[model samples]
Target: MSTMLQWPASRPARPGDPLVDSFGRVHSDLRVSLTDRCSLRCTYCMPEQGNLWLERSTLLDAAEIEAIARVAALDGVDTFRLTGGEPLLRRDLAEIVRRLAALTVGGRPVEVSMTTNGIGLAGRIDELAAAGLSRVNISLDTVRADRFAELTKRDRLADVLDGIRAAAASGLRPLKLNTVAMRGVNDDELHDLVDLAVEHGAELRFIEQMPLDAGHTWDRSTMLTRDEILETLSARWRLTEVDGRGDSPAERFHLDGGPHTVGVIAAVTAPFCGACNRLRLTADGQVRNCLFARDELDLRRVLRSELSGTERDAALDSVLRASVLGKQAGHGIDDPEFLQPGRGMNAIGG
Candidate 1:
């Protein structure tokens, strides 16, 4: 089967417009994968040794990323989320962030944020913040060092904690911490994880584990549900629903005993496909309309081809538009015929 996704032959015609799908979903948020290389081997993300690393030559460079991002910005993409196997692994991240931050939309600078594992973020928080990184989301599954090692195959809990603190100190307040909700693993630490976030004025986000594991060993029965997570957190503290979620994935709540809020992504049980305004660009330059999408459009070919400058822009515009046009109404996780994606979360940019 061909990997390239074909543009709909029967869909309505609207060429060279904003990134809006047939469902009237306007994509204003762009998720860019800086690299597919990660430091840790999380149980829910990938196996100890599963997916191979993407070639450095294939991964988009700073200028390449900026060029594609510029195209999106012109098309009304106001915010860019830098994702990865671990985004900080890219040594030129600050420069990339600076370039992205410089992009203007409606006379305002386009937002640039990142989702990382926080392994190497401590010392660079200040530098990144200075270079136009608006905010950050760091993944910390467990607060216990032993459990962290068990979950992520790393004993870098101390380093992650330090990065969290440094991010807060650098004024990245409402610092978001991403926690993948596994059934038996780390489920017992909801309160402790929330406490860890509250202590540093961070938002603890509980993401229901999806079927994006590299090992493809995810059992639906073993996954934690959204209700189960709320039941546990509500038992510890009173949770008042925060208003105005908009298109944000995490459904937030105010912890009565704390100054900050907590969130739950609930990707599986409570999929937010309707309000999803996200588009993903893979490390190798394939644009995915959805994370679970079976197909993607290749932008690398159009990027490196012998098209003229104007022709290149037109080609990129078509690719970006087609990506959004192929949006699925929902991820269809509940449908009996639904199959897990071949690419894992690491390769899909989280």
Candidate 2:
């Protein structure tokens, strides 16, 4: 298969585009966190005990978010992806999608995507699709209901599975499943998930466990590195690497004559920052350069200020400048001295 080069060039990037990074990488992709609330409390991604969330009045409104999206499109950003603890948790989310879909980059088009836990997706998939949802990424770490309950501390495995089925039925092709590979956690179901992908024609991606929470329970011993995972799964079927999609960190591969493919995201074992061409916009309107970094600039502050035109442009300029310098050579999460941020992954819109 050829590489997916659907990105349009007519999305003209200007000198003062608010989100452009220093490496000449136009911050074309905006990952927006709709809310910090989620139903399931995953051990690695979110706190088992839960924590306080940002005040509702302080969070950006749908109109404010749409304004940011329009500004991003004007700059060169042609992709607007919605993420959250679970995007479905937001009320009137379809309306949000509808508003973002109205924005365009230059004469070109912008891609709209979303990521969800898939529990609440069944009822909302059609509405979201009708509202201009281009694609969706669903997280399913374990296939077994028992293990799923143990991992997520919820009995929504059935709903998640039904959601996947409904999404597939809705003709949402190329539905991607994100699984975090933990040694004693869902590692046993690795091949089972591959088989699930094969059965559904969906792509299953194994993401290495990342360190972000204040929970010190995460250790290297629990990590099933990407290499070990591939070696283990190779015994079940002959695998061939698929050549396409350079921006994706996943190493794509397929089983011999299988209907589906598998991907490995080696963020911890091997970082892909050099090829990183993405920027993240938190729910509070902060621009995060790197996921593990504790630094960020609150764009909400300027968006709420009395500034207009060039003043707002200058504020965004300072943010873009700071992001360039703050872009670390690589994250130090693996190092012992690397202090993990107190924030949960859900808060940052994974």
- Model 1, which residues run further than 4 Å from truth? 1-16
Number of clashes recorded per candidate: 0, 1
Q: Clash number for model 2?
A: 1
lDDT tens digits by residue: candidate 1, 39-67 = 99998888887568888899999988998
Which clashing pairs does model 2 show? 28-77
TM-score of 2: 0.90
State the RMSD for candidate 2: 4.1
lDDT of each: 0.87, 0.78
